[model samples]
Target: MPDGGLDPVIHAPARLRVVATLAALGPGDELSFPKLQKLLDMTAGNLSTHLRKLEDAGYVHVTKTHEGRTPATYLRLTGAGRAAFEAYTTALTTLLRGTAS
Candidate 1:
């Protein structure tokens, strides 16, 4: 979006999708990396990159461990992240409504 245009609450499509998915799940529920990848239909590398961005932004928390033979990665949203996502959705809704009117 342009500087004068509406500053979107969720700027990146993939990030928005991630946040939206997390919001749909029960609060504090953690999603495994592979599961989230399947849900988003995103590649491991791509998902990792997006997740890194979210992690850096303090929107998501990542945990890595080994489940016997395989490695596991889990993601959960932070309180601030959840609140920001909610605000963004609300802003988007209002903007869409204004345009419709």
Candidate 2:
């Protein structure tokens, strides 16, 4: 009714980028922290903050493990996250097409 309302949580620029990156991964696939940081061109602390927000919202699943004594962080989108992203895209498309519903 409001031109396909946008998701406040995913509307932030940083959060949008994070969600988009995660959405690009194949189903059940994950991206490493360093990879994400490089891809997004974000600082380690900045990326970590955004990840924490997404994780807190249950939109992301994070796994921390050791790879040859090096800590590795992996991030994946949850089913709920995938669904929310889909809806967000749909709403954006609808708004862009000037079809407000």
Q: TM-scores for all candidates? A: 0.85, 0.92
RMSD of each: 3.0, 1.8
Clashing pairs in 2: 1-101
Encode model 2's per-residue lDDT on 24-81: one tens digit a residue: 9987899999999999999999988988888888889999999998999999998888
Candidate 1's displacement at residue 8, Å, is 6.0
**What C-alpha lDDT, on a 0 to 100 scale, does residue 93 get in candidate 2?**
91
Top TM-score model: 2
Task: List the candidate 2 regions with Cα displacement exceeding 4 Å.
Answer: 1-3
lDDT of 1: 0.80
Q: Which candidate is the best by lDDT?
A: 2
Determine which window of 10 residues in candidate 1 has minimal summed lDDT: 1-10
Residue 18, model 2, lDDT: 94
